[model samples]
Target: MNIDLRVIGEAFHQFLINIGLTSGQASLIDWIFGALILLVIFIVLAILLIWFERKLAGRVQDRLGPNRVGPFGLIQPIADTLKLFTKEDITPAGADRITFNLAPTLAVFSIVMAFAVIPFADKVIGTDINVGVVYLMAFASVSSMSLLMAGWASNNKYALLGGFRVVAQLMSYEIPMAFAMLLPVLLAGTMRMNGLVEAQGQFFGLGWNIWIMPAAFIIYLTTALAEGERAPFDLLEAESEIVAGYNIEYSGLKFAWFYLAFFMNTWVLSAVATTLFLGGWQGPFVSQVPALGVVYFLGKTIIMFVIFAWIRATFPRLRIDQMMSFCWKVLVPMVLVLFLLTAIILKLGLPTIAVWLLILLSNVAVFVIALWLLGKGLEKSKWASKRLFTPEIPRL
Candidate 1:
C-alpha cells in the first residue's frame, strides 16, 4: 500500500468526498476548518509559552517557578487570564479611545496572520503560495503600526517616544532580516515554505540550510531577536527609561493583549527560523512515520524558544544609540556581504557539494571576522567605561 502522508486538509477532503460533497465545497470546508484549528492551536500555545518562559527564567535564576499553581504551574496562565478578565479595562483620560482600543487587536492580528503560510509538518500547512516568504515578511511588518497607534493614541510622552523608537528600531532591522532570508530562496529557487524544507531532505539529518548558510543563519537569528523586540533589543519597553513604553497607559485585557502578542511574536519567529533554516519537520524515518514530522517540528521549535529565553535572561538592554549602531553599522553590512558571496558562489557553477562546502567555509570566516571587528570597536568605544560600571548593579 502507498504511504499515507496526507495532512488534515487532504484527509478532510477525502472524507468529504465519501460523504458526497463537491470538490469545491470540500476544499472550502477544509480551508475553514484548517484556519480555525490553527487559530485555536496558537492561542493555547501562547498561553502555555507564558508559563514556560516564567519557569525557564526561574530556573536560570536558581528558583522554582510557579510551583504552587497547577502541575508545574501550568494552570497559572489560566488563572492569570481570569484575573485580567476580572480587572477593569481602564483607558487613559487623554487617550484616543478608538485607536487605543484597536491597537491591541491589530497587534495580535498581524502575527496570527503570518501563521497562515507556515508549514508545521510534512503536508501540513495553512496555505501554500508561490510567494509565501514575501507574504510572511509583509504581514509581520503590520504589527509595527499597531505599536505606533498604541503609543500615539495614549498621548503620553514616554509612550510616543517609545512608538518612535519602535518605528526606527523595527525598520532598521527589517532590511538585514530580509537579506538574510534571501539566501534560502536563492538556493531553493522557490519561495514556497514546504519547498524550502523539501530541498534539504536529501541528506536526512545533515541537510539543513543552517549547515551551509551559517552566516545567514547567524544574521537571521540576531536580526530576529531585534525584530521580535526580545531582550537587548527590547527598547520598546526599556523599563528604566520609559516605564513600560508605548503601552504604559493600557491596563486590564488591553494590556494583556499587548504582552501576549509580544510573546506570540517571539514564538512565531522561532518557528519560522526553524522551518526556514533548520530541517523543519524532516528527520530520519520521518517519511515512513509521517506523524513524527509534527513531533520533530515541535521539538525544534521548543529548542529555538529556549535559546530565545536564554538570551533574554543573559543580556542587558542596549542603549538607543548602540541599538541603532548595531543594526545599520554591523548587521546590515554583514547580510549584504553574505548575499553577495552567495550570488558569486552560484555564478561560479561549481558542483552541488562543492558549492555547499564553499559557502559553509565562507560563513565560518565571516562570523570570525565579525567577532574580531566587534571586539576592536568595543575597545575604542566611549561606552566601554559605562559597560565596566554595569557589574555594580544588583540583580534580583
Candidate 2:
C-alpha cells in the first residue's frame, strides 16, 4: 500500500525519454500533463467547495440545503454549473470589450499560476524554485489588476466603485499578509515551500510554525480572509451596497469563471496557510509513506477551509471603514511588531528551544495586548453603551 506516485511518474518519464523524445521534450510534456491534472483538480474542488459551503451555511442557519439535487446535495453544484453554461453571455454596449473579457480570465489565471509554487506533497510540486514564496506573492497580486480591469472596463459606475474597493481592500490587507508570511520563511531560513515544510519535521511532526508564532498565523488568516474576499471582509462584492461589485457586469460563462476562481482561491489560500503554519504533509509515518503526505496536506487544507466557512457563516460583514481601519490600525502594526520580535529573537544565537520559547512568549504577549486594545476601542464606540433591553423592564 506504500504507493509512491513519484516513482511511477519517474518511470513514465524515463519511458518517454527512451522512446526517441529529448529530455526537454519529455519535461515539456510532463509539465503540460501536470498542469492539466492540476486544472482538473481545481474544477473538482470548486464543485465540492460550493456544495460544502452551501451545506455549512444551511446548517448554520438551521435549514436543509440542496438535498433534492443529489445525495446529500452533492450534485447541486454540477447542476448549477450546467445552468451557468447555458445562460446567455452578455456584454455591456459601452464597455471596453477587450479588458472586460480579459479580467475574469486573468483572475483565474493569476490564482492558477500562484498554485505553481505550492508543494502539495513530498517531491510533489509543480516546480521547486528557489524563490517560491516570492513567486507566489507576485502572482497573487495579479488578481488585483484583474479586478481593476473588470471594474474599470465595465462602463458601470457600480462596477467601477467595486474595482476601486479592490485596490483599497486587497492592497491594504496584502501588506500584513506578506509580513505574516515572512515568519515561516525566516524561521526555516529559506523561501522554498518544501524547505518550510521540512523545517517543521522536528519533534515527531509536532514542530509546527503556528506553535511558535501563533500571532503571525492569526494575522495571516485575518488578512487572507480579506484577500480572498470571504465574509466579514467581503466588501469587494457587497451586493447590498455595490450591486454585486466588480463582477456585476459579468454573466454566463464569463461570470462562471469568476465564480470558479473565487472558490479555487479560497482552497489555494487555505493550502498555503496550512503549509505555512501546520506541519504540512509532515504527519506520522509520512517520511516512510510519501503518498500519505498528500493525504495529510489535503486534510489540513480542508480543516482550514472549514474554519473559513465557519467564520463566513457566523460573522456579519464589516463596514468598509471598520475593515480598513482594522487592517491599518490593528493587524498591520501588530504583524510588524511580531515580525520584528521574532527576527530579533532568532538573531540572538540562542538554542533552538530558547528561540521557540521566546518567540512563543512574545506572540502570547502581543495577542493579549491586541485584545485589550481592541476591547478598549470597542467600549468607546457608541454601540457599546446602547442596549435594546434593560434588566428593570418587563417583556412587552
Poorest lDDT segment (10 consecutive residues) of candidate 1: 1-10
Worst 10 residues of 2 by lDDT: 381-390
TM-score of each: 0.94, 0.95
Q: Clashes per prediction?
A: 0, 0
Question: What are the C-alpha RMSDs, in order, of all predicted structures?
Answer: 2.4, 2.3
Evaluate all candidate structures by whole-model CA lDDT and list the values in order: 0.88, 0.89
Q: How far out, in Å, is residue 277 in model 2?
A: 0.3
* Best by the TM-score measure: 2
| Candidate 2 lDDT by residue in tens digits, 283-325 | 9989778889999999999999999999998988888878888
Off by over 4 Å in 2: 1-3, 381-396
